[model samples]
Target: MAMRKAKVQEQVVQAVARSNPGDRLVATVHGISGPAPQLTMAFGFIMLFVVKYYFVTVTERAVVVHRAAKFTGRPGDVVFNLPREQAHGIASEVRHGRQWNSFRLLFPGAAKPTRINVAAPWANDLGRLLSALGAAAPASG
Candidate 1:
């Protein structure tokens, strides 16, 4: 399982690298693509219904979210390429003694923010992932 994850992660990095040759890959967190609040009751059900999860990756230049295919977990398409400046408003919370990170990814020119729910084990990586996103974000001058 670890080997497969690493392989898919490499593929994702390679895909992002093609469009952003100079931008280096930083962190990636796989998340359920929906509102955390709404999915509270049917979280497990929703996850089971989901055919693809968002492979949210942070690079030196941007925060990119891709629809990762099942089984292989390879990235399918570039769903979002959020400018570092727009990388804001995500928060970490503890619910029922479990760590959960919820955020709405607002892509430029888009009508709405894409909700991403990250649960523990995966949410365990949020500290560094969030740091990478913030580290590359443009200063609000």
Candidate 2:
């Protein structure tokens, strides 16, 4: 199972590289649905086709968010472009009532950070991405 997951991550990295040439891939993760009840009001059947994606790629100068449809001629979006001399941070929080985890990119002078919800399996990838962001952030006294 671990090997399979690694293979999938590698594929995502490759895809990101192909989509955005010249950008380094720091980490990649498979998208999972948020912690929400699968059942709907109309019927007891679960909604299995949720369009949740968290394809994050952290590069040297910016953090890119590749949509699930990037392969279909769609361009990857830049979540945050690092400044030359500005401090940045990544934060994670778990909402008790919603029972979901949120990872955010805290940029310098930004009122609201860019946030994404991820399930448990993708938490490790989020942590690695956060570490990369921290490494790339500007030093502060």
Candidate 3:
């Protein structure tokens, strides 16, 4: 299991590093991409067919996300990319009276952090991401 994790981690690092040559990688994770702008929350069920996975790559200079239709593959079109300077900690809140394994990207000066977000459900490495962004996540709903 350790070997597999290392191998997959290496692949994710490589993919991010290839596109962002100058930035140093911090952490990377796979997650379910957030809903599209045109689609309302009422239609979230349709995302299952439109997207299968999203790869979020965090580097010293930025936090980037790439959408993917397959589980094991390179990053596709760029979905979300926030530079470190404008980035803030990830917010993980309890919703529906439960701990949803999801998170939202925060911006230091943005009035509404969740206004334009690239939320993801596979956000288990919350600590790593928060540390990289240098902010605390509010646990409130």
Maximum-TM-score candidate: 1
Q: Which residue pairs collide, candidate 3?
A: none
Residue 4's lDDT within candidate 1 is 59
Instruction: Name the 10 consecutive residues with the lowest summed lDDT in model 1.
Output: 89-98
Task: Write down the TM-score of every candidate.
Answer: 0.66, 0.51, 0.58
lDDT of 2 at 69: 41
lDDT per residue as tens, model 3, 1-141 = 012445656776776776778778787765544454336345655655654466667798888876654545555776667887766554444222133344554434557543222233324454466557664533433
**CA lDDT of every candidate:** 0.63, 0.49, 0.56
TM-score of candidate 2 to 2 decimals: 0.51
Model 2 lDDT at residue 49? 44
lDDT of 3 at 38: 36
Report the Cα lDDT for residue 136, model 3: 51
Positional deviation of 29 in candidate 2, in angstroms?
Answer: 3.0
After superposing candidate 1, which stretches have Cα over 4 Å from the reference?
A: 1-3, 35-52, 86-100, 135-141
* Model 2: residues with Cα > 4 Å off, grouped in runs: 1-4, 31-51, 69-100, 105-115, 135-141
